[model samples]
Target: MITETRVKIDWDSLGFDVVKTKSMFKATCPIDGKWSEGSLVPYGTIQLSPAAGVLNYGQGVFEGTKAFRTVKGDVILFRPDRNAQRMAFSTKRLCIPEMDTEFFLDAVLKTVQDNIDYVPPYGKGSLYIRPIVWGTAPALGVRPVSEYTFMIFVSPVGPYFKGGVKPLNLKVSTQFHRAAAKGIGNAKAIGNYSASLFPLMKAKSEGFDEVIYLDAIDGKRVEELGSANLFIYKEGVIRTPALSGSILEGVTRNSVCRIASDILNIPVEETDVDITDVLKAEEVFCTGTAVVVTPVGKITYQGETTTINGNQMGSVTEKIRQTILAIQRGEMNDPFGWIFPVNQIFKR
Candidate 1:
């Protein structure tokens, strides 16, 4: 059993950077064996061979979720089951052994519980959970490896954007493609993120907060950002790009849609969103586990810039952000059964 030990830190000054916690959960499996019973281990680095399959062929997948210190003095996970399901899908796509959802959830629970002391206070921030799987065995060929490793780690992080909750300025990138059609873009593959780094860096250097990529098939429809899903509210309707086998299926995007339709009684649709629709949108925002619901103040494409909602966060955008935060922090009733109270289920 892992004992809970309090980790002292400057929670008030916490940012999105990784703050190491007490322990991490780890487990391993061979190509012909089942996953071993995982346990909490002291947080540290693991050795890997130079020719490891993950290092050579990029056979790794990762999932992100959050555990919040709620107003009710409880530590709860927000829709972690969805993350587990996505991880399984990603592993299958990468030709790795499919991860059982139960196994994934149990590992996350153990990791979070072991680091329960790092869960920030009710309003400071939430503990970010990252679950990753990779092919660990050394390999010189291009085929599947002989072994795999799955690890879960927790970090206490604040806002993703450094400058508080300000509206973002995004640039439409027609020069690069995030992921190709009929590719592993739908999976949370590590290679997909590696491909996005250059475009994101170039966008940042050009004075944009993020780069929004268009569909790989045709450069007409908007896809998503480097790390978040895009949404536009126009004519009282909310629309995001359809999951066209390229865009990542974001958990926060799904939550925002559900909250819009069920709680706020707003119309929501997932369809092919064109650049023209975004240029004329009443409100624009992006969603992810890290960036929650950050509004896009402006979008620039081909020397033309369009200011959204007069370069301010729209009322509807704020409504969605607040509503989701409320549910996560236990400030409001959870009608969708999303919050998983970990402290209640697993006592210290």
Candidate 2:
């Protein structure tokens, strides 16, 4: 049986902390063209070569998703297959071996199952699943390693932003850009984030929650925030920068499009968005696996500031959040079949 004791959770505390748990699912890949036996083992890390390829060449990729508790004590993962497909795209960009979609999803499902008891209740938080694939082989020179290890782990997490979703203040930084045209911006790679820290810190210190990065080449089009995809609501229409080669094609972004059009009857604009126009939008926000949806209240452009929806959460934002959360908690009919069930009823 799993080992940790539950601490009588409040069932409404959506905070990010590791609930004491017994084991995590693990697997290893070797150059023998095979993956060894994967099993549920105590959570820990293994040794790696000091000169690993991942260290030298940044040969790694990862995907993030969550598993939420149902009303009946069941755990469910949201669109894990979509995350698997995105992981494949990330792996290919790094020249890492790809796990078949079925195998990838199976690994996540099994891992979440092993950690199901740790999933928080209805309003608390969900268990965060992280699947990382990195080159294991060591080489003095820079090149893709011959062997790679793809493994998965789970952690009980609260709302990523804590407390609640509030309108955010943004600082526009024209000095450094998040991603460039025809670059690795579209991939979920580690380096992409490693490069955003300094600038993000600067923005934070400058009285902003986040920095909206613009295109590097032209400095006119909006790309994305450090971690989420951006959106603009204007003229009774939602417009987001078209998925050019530079933006990560987000799963949440895709779902919002379908949800908006099919359920809310709102048409969306998918094309390049001018940074100025986006900042001046009536309603601006971002979406991702973590933040689900967030409203941008104000943008601090070059010496000028604009308030999107008066820096308040818009009506559309509330509707989207409610519908999405209802679907995730299994309280609403899932017309899209985005959830994957992971638990069985018990007599505890």
Candidate 3:
């Protein structure tokens, strides 16, 4: 049990930004060997070579998940194993050494335990956990490094959007492409995100919350939002873009589909979504670990605007959001076995 003195923080006012906690977990591996047993270290800057592989060739990948403090004060993680599986896929795609599932889960659990006091109170927000792996060896050659580093850090975050759960205005970008057809889009690689910075900034400057990226091949089919997966509720069916090689397989997106189909008893479909159809949907929303679920009020494509659900969050979106939040916070039964209690892993 974490019996340390709790840190004083204004949890309610927190945003989706980095607030450095007390400690983090780190491990390293050599080219010819396996990863070391990692240790928890005080949070600080890590020494990296200027010519490190991650700096030069962008040989890195990351995963985002959260730990919520239940109403009874027990901290629990939401689908961390799934995050580990996704990270493994990302590492393999980047030619980096894959981390063991057990090792990855341990690093995350210990990092959260080491900083348990920093977890925001129930209903305030959750402690966002980020695990990243990168090639650390310095070399001028454009290849995988002989050494790699894996680290996990936690930050208390409220919501990705400024006003939590409110509708957002998004713009469709046909010029900038988030990922290529045969590129590393499916992988949670660092390069994929770096490519989105420009388009995301452009959308935000135009008074939009985020940019909705279209397919690179034709720019007609919807790919996803810059930072999340897109979903639309139409004609009593919840639809989202199929996981093409160019779209990321989001953990929350999977959960939403399952919950909608099994729990909510709504038909769910994952297929190619055209921008034209999205503009006419009954309700539109985006899903991810950081945002949880955010309803889209309007989408502007090619100087045209369309409002969803009368410019408000629809009934279906609100119900799904509340159900997922309830399961995450231990306020309801987790029929899917998604919630893993921290106490079950580490006894007090």
Candidate 4:
């Protein structure tokens, strides 16, 4: 195992682009539950064969979330338990070792808390937590590797997009589909993201910031972005793509729905979102822990373009984003109990 060596950090120039933290937590898959002790070490590479299962068979899953500093000098983690459960779903689909829910949460909390200093100030930015589980053994054939590893780390991140809260233009990819219907579309697995790199780049080169992937089967319905789940707002109501077994069950997406209904008194509709409807939507936006709330201004389809209402974050969006931010900052009342404060730690 490698060790995390502390280095000088340029906090003044930090953005949400690269990994800054040097330390991470790692634990190997326990054969028959005979797990080895975990460790907090330098964030570095793991030894693997050229014919590793992950290299050939693409066996892996991942998760993304953030920890933020509250207004009152406290660190809070936005809904973390949901991340654990989602990992379970990803593991089940990728044939990886079942991560014990309790253990998973415990490890992640400890990992983030250990690097609390890496967490930025209340308003500057946040600590991004990325947990990855992957097969380690080298396998030339198409089979699950017997050995696996799980690790978590933290890095302070700024606005996910280069510009802050700027409206984005997206393109509908009718050629390359995001995910297969029954395949790993819903799972936050490695290959799923790997498959997106090409099409996303093509869309980027085509003068769009993001590519909106459609269902592979028919290519008529909307799926999601390369990184986050999508939501559409219009006519005093919010709408998003339903979990069609191809859409990842996004934690932030769910929270937005709850806030819209319980707090804002707006109805949130989760169902099949027709690409054409979103094109004609009064407002279009996407949500995730990283992106937060980003409004879509225009979508370029072939040669035609459809503009969302006002081409800016709507009033409802502003309200919900502020509400959620307040909850994270421990400012307003947490009526829904979405934020989880760290109270325990795992000492080495």
Candidate 5:
């Protein structure tokens, strides 16, 4: 079994990589149509059939979110309910049984509590929660499985970028599309990422931090970064691509829109953003659960490059990042009732 004693490590040097914690939560369901009450188990691998549905057909979905250790020595989760809702949406599309919000939140909270000792210090990092559901039954045809597994694991991770909080150089991919216009792009399916691997690798090899995919149909409208949602600011307005059924609606992206409009009093718009608008924007950034908000220094498209905010982080971007981080870490008030204290769920 995984231990409660914290392992020794350089927390300051942590990256957005997996470092297994004490325990994980798991449950199973069979064709009989009943889900077992999940339990906390030691962190380890599980045996699967050679023809497991997930292995063969990629019938799986997952979520990424973080739990922070507050300055007051409390652990808190940020908008887990939204993650639960998104997971349900994904599973429904994949034809897998969806877990209710109560069960999903309970599993996440229990896993965090079981691995409490591994929760990084407030400033060092936060505990990253990954909840995945997969079809487990052996299958030979392209169909849903009769058996399924749901599990959640926790890890402590630092910033996604190696250098931390710096503007990233992005490359636009016209030769490839991350998702079709009427496909499962909006779902958190494992297959969606698998399709992006080659383009992302090519972008990295070309010295770009990430790749921004254009729409599959016209290949002119902006979609999103490989792992995050895109946003551009110009003339006191913040605009991001609308939910065109091809972009993953990011939790951080939603939070930024709300914070910008409600707190910062800045106008926010969701519409079809042309690539030219991105090239001329005063500032550009991407948001995700992992990379909360990262500025874009430069974007290259069709052998032409454009610099945003003189290749520096914009003031509005900085303010939005700070405000969200502050609310997450409990340094500022969360008027939206987004923060859920772990202590309230599980006694210390």
Candidate 6:
């Protein structure tokens, strides 16, 4: 096993970028065989044939979750089971071999434990875990490949957005649709993100932090951000875009809704969020595994920019963010049983 002392990292200056760790977990599934027993491998580049299905046909799916070094000097994962379930969903959707949830969770635990020392000290940052599966067999036809590889890697990262926790300025993109109504937008497929890169980069060039995409069918209802789910608050009620087979069901988004309803006693609704509603919203925010619960300060659509709650993080948004963070850091009681302690899992 590789030890962590071989690498030197400045944890204090960590950003939302990859800081290579000691090892990663890898497992392979043949075309007609089950997944192999995985093991830890050194973090490095992977080789793939030019005619690989994942390269030529875009057959791949990935998941993102974090491991936190809690205040009590123990490492934990927030709702890893949910991530495991999601990965299985994504794999099935992409025509890849379905991974057992237990196998997925076990792989994640082993990978994180091998790189445990890279998990920053409490309050510094988190170990970002990325689990990815791709078709590795070379193929010329537009079909599923003969082999698949599942790998999990970790990186120490800070906030997703620079200047940590500050409200974001977003642009409403009517010209670009994130995912089609019946497409793979619901899955965490690699293609879904590639489609957003152009729009996202354009939004950044326009002095916006991110882009908010609308539904592809009618283009009237708000779908989600480039990489996060959208939320808006009005009249003491919290609402997000409904999961209408076009939106990715985010783990953080679900957690936010649950926390708002159960802990904060705020009403949460998943329905069609129109552009008009977003304009009139008193509060706007986005959630994801990486972005977490971040406030939207301003929203611009069709030449008009609406400032949300005087361009600051709303009280409700702040409350929800704090509550989730507290629970994640083990500073508050986890009424939802979302926290998964790594040490406890290892003991078993």
Report residue 258 deviation for candidate 5 (angstroms): 0.5
For model 4, what is the C-alpha lDDT against the true structure?
0.82
Can you tell me which runs of candidate 4 are displaced by over 4 Å? 1-12, 30-36, 344-348
TM-score for each predicted model, relative to the true structure? 0.97, 0.92, 0.97, 0.93, 0.96, 0.97
Q: Quick one: RMSD of model 4? A: 3.9
Q: Which candidate leads the pack in lDDT?
A: 1
What does candidate 5's lDDT look like per residue over 205-292, in tens digits?
Answer: 9999999999999989999998999999999999999999989989999999999999999999999999999999999999999999
Cα lDDT of model 6 by residue, 1-348, tens digit: 222444677777889998878899999998676665989999999999999999998999999999998889899999989988988889999989887888899999999999988988888888999999999999999999999999999999889999998899999998888899989998999999999999999999999999999988888999999899999999999999999998999999999999999999999999999999998999999999889899999999998988989999999999999998998888999999889999776453
Q: Could you tell which candidate, 1 or 6, scores higher by lDDT?
A: 1
Model 4 over residues 159-221: C-alpha lDDT tens digits? 888878888899888888878888888889898889999999888888888989988878889
Per-residue alpha-carbon lDDT of candidate 1 for residues 85-174, written as tens digits (9 for 90 to 100): 999899889988888888898899888888889998889889999999999999998998999999998899889998878999999998
* Model 3 regions more than 4 Å off: 1-5, 346-348
- Determine which window of 10 residues in candidate 4 has minimal summed lDDT: 1-10
- lDDT of residue 116 for candidate 6: 88
Identify the runs in model 6 with alpha carbons over 4 angstroms from their true place. Answer: 1-7, 346-348
Instruction: State model 5's lDDT.
Output: 0.91
Candidate 2 per-residue lDDT, tens place, 217-238, comes to: 8899998899889988888898
Please, what is the whole-model Cα lDDT of each candidate in the order they appear? 0.92, 0.80, 0.91, 0.82, 0.91, 0.91
Write the residue-wise lDDT of candidate 3 on 75-97 in tens digits: 99999999989998999899888
Query: What's the CA error at residue 11 for candidate 2, in Å?
Result: 5.6
Candidate 1 residue-wise lDDT at 132: 93
Task: At residue 229, give the lDDT of candidate 4.
Answer: 86
